[model samples]
Target chain A: MIEFTMPSLGADMESGTFVEWLVKPGDAVRRGQVVCVIETQKGAVEVEIWDEGVVERLVARPGDELPVGAVMAVLRGAAEPAGRADKPSPPAAERTPRASRPAKPQGGPPTTPAMPAAGRPRISPAARRRAVELGIDPATLVPSQPGAPLQLADVERAAAHPVAASTTRVAPSTSAEARKQAMREAIAAAMSRSNRDIPHYYLGTTLRLDAALDWLEAHNATRPLAERALLAALQLRAVALALRDVPALNGWYSEGAFLQAPDVRIAVATSLRGGGLVTPALRDVDQLSLPDLSGRLRDLLTRARGGQLRSSELSDATITVTNLGELGMESVFGVIYPPQVALVGFGRVVERPWVADGALVVARTVHASLAADHRATDGAVGARFLTRLAEYLEQPETLWKPES
Target chain B: METGKLNPGALRKILFDCIASVAPEADFEALRTDRPWREELEIDSFDFQNILIAVSKRLGIEVPESDYRKLATLDTFVRYLAERMGAAG
Candidate 1:
């Protein structure tokens, strides 16, 4: 039997809520078909199953949060025996409680609308949690079903309208505000852990960018709007290429040791339109052409803002790159997202005075900085990585046909 | 030929539409025209480039990278496009 499990997104993500399943039992599934949608800190991600089989059993409901590596479904091999397909699901260890729900009273999954058996209003655990986050008292909400247990939807519907009938001062924050608060708390927790655990070393450099700008101008002059690669994409490509020269800076440092990752995935720090930020990594940056990379970046941004990023894109970055340059910052010494050892930052390109071949001339340049964990790599390795990065930028034509 | 009849009113409508297309989540009714609309609306430079590209296509104008700074705000963009469009006529 093939077991479909909940895939972990980022280092911080512990579990994901199963929104819905695309395929049902007895359906023959092919490789790479999106089987389910999982809600994580990254937003609603369509999770794809890579194995091909006939689905036998679905283990979780819509509201259940499947923990990392938790078996979400069981699929039978096409050639296997038909009689064994009736076998029950695996033991209780795989069917863990949803992280949002409080600890269940009588162990095992809540097969029923089980509430605190002793309470008067017998509120469902999820409803009580939702009410707390929405700043509404669970007791204040009226259940839609008279005798049935109060569900999460009832609390949400009640929170939609102001609690004017009640006397408690409810926080004047909406669902969006609550979500924003949650995202901020998540970021704070990650960054705080990074500061407390990792010994960070910072390095800064100024690179003249006339050649890169000129190459970009020439490349984009005749191209259509969709094919144009922004400077952000170009910078990412350069970073991906530069990582080859210094592999130590391209992987995660965990458990007092640096673990090198094979593929060079660069996480981009993209800002959401509504609020908050998500660093979704582009897979295999070194393999993409400038135009292709830019197109992917464009698509990534649209999906990120639309809250439709896939589960595969949210996890497993070797490094993080931020372009505050686009935001018009002179330079930024950013915090490194944990597990990943380093963060590469680029500031806005501005025209500055420079001496070119013993003659003073005005040239456009940008400041790039690297914040790396000291345990992973020393300053010299980072300096070399920066030097290679600068070389790639200064001679921009090479980026189009970068050496493998 | 479609851009020959371009007026400030039409230009504003097109600008709003382009911005909307790039960032559909932006609250256009409360958006301020005089301020730097890109930052105000949280349209990053990449997405902002998308807006400019769409605008340039609709208006039949070629905006060089150098003049991107000159069109940061709605008033500045309308003024910049109007002058060039008049010169073309």
Candidate 2:
């Protein structure tokens, strides 16, 4: 009989859900056929069969969360004698609620394996417990030999024995440590390439936000209890509408040229409340109405705080917007998210001193800054784009009106 | 048990639900049985494993990773599993 254990789907995955099975017991399987689908931290994938066999039993079921390396099924040759129905069942001992485990005193050996005495390997119970904690398969821990009895000493010896220091390592570089290093390296490379290879230009402007702020306050006056921060929503909508006229800022430079996309995929840089940063994309922002944009922004913020966003939502942003208004900052020079050619920074909309028609005056104003990639864009182009965007922001009425 | 008895709709629903749970925002039609799961869902290595684990747990089946890397789509997943479990669909 061949034991079908939970395989590590990726370097970082420690456990997975048995979402569904494509096959049932007594089914004939051929080599290279997917027998089951497992849900890991990443996503869903179909797992295939190796040796042609008949699935002897079904082990896990939908919603069952099993640790990586746990045995979930058993496969035997087409004509092998059938084992008992409970043959592959995990021993009752393993079912002991984790809350009841005996506390270890100064790490004097680990807990025993949950399996019964009969099927237990020859290794010490303490070693079995330690192996479980380490997520190491005891069977695999012992060297593969025809009939050698496994022991704790053998496991310890194996642990002590290090790979030949001088021998060239032949294994693929995909271990957890290696993968983490690769991710960091990728981020570093992208940052350096963007900063060095992509010529960037910075432009700053301050615009009065009294009308927008007034609109937000009046709109929220009749809103539901849960509706607050309507001003940010309006600002985001304004920026989205502004991008429709400034199409050149809504794309990335790839393959030695700027690739203009049809819709503006704007990324909102949201800092999780006392947590990590997440940038969820609001696709085709130019098409969404003001109310729709407000609803989506609320939803995105909620999901970002709850840590519920999928992997795809976290990648591939053409442009990013960071609002420091909530943080009470007046202005900030934004750093460009890699592969994105531009980033917009917005500051608090506070009443500040200004001169109008050569007379000193106090007027409501919000500071804004735009960082553009100078590699594919020039000062003239950036100025024109910013000019069009500012015109939309200052007028505000024409932004919502559809072009006929 | 009789083989080839599982309804295609039932199986398809089960499969799609499993995928949607993991990637709620993914375009379902893009997750065609004809396309490889990775290409169809645009799943990376880590996400791929999580999906595999969910499939295994939900279906009461165990899929070895070495073998799973060979499957490309929904059809292959069913066909291979049918053969392995000694059933037909």
Candidate closest to the true structure, highest TM-score: 1
- CAPRI-style quality class for the chain A–B interface of candidate 2: incorrect
How far is B46's C-alpha from truth in model 2 (Å)? Answer: 31
Write the residue-wise lDDT of candidate 1 on A1-404 in tens digits: 77788876655668877755656677798765777766665556667776667988888666676788888899986766655533323223212111110010111111112121113253565564455456555546567888676788887787667554251334422244445565676677678878888899999999999999889888888876667778888799899989987899987777678887777888788766555677767876888877778888888876665555665556567788988777778898988888788999999898999999999999999999999999999999999999999999999988867464
Worst 10 residues of 1 chain A by lDDT: A99-108
Q: Write the per-residue lDDT of candidate 2 for residues B1-89, one digit (tens) a residue.
A: 22344455655566566676556666766556776666445443334444655665555445544355456687877666555545522
Query: Model 1's chain B TM-score?
Result: 0.88
For candidate 1, the per-residue lDDT at B88 reads 80
Show model 1 residue runs off by greater than 4 Å: A78-174, A402-404, B1-4, B23-36, B56-67, B84-89
How far in Å is the alpha carbon of A350 misplaced in model 2?
2.4
- Complex DockQ per candidate: 0.31, 0.01
Q: TM-scores for all candidates?
A: 0.77, 0.47
- lDDT for every model? 0.72, 0.56
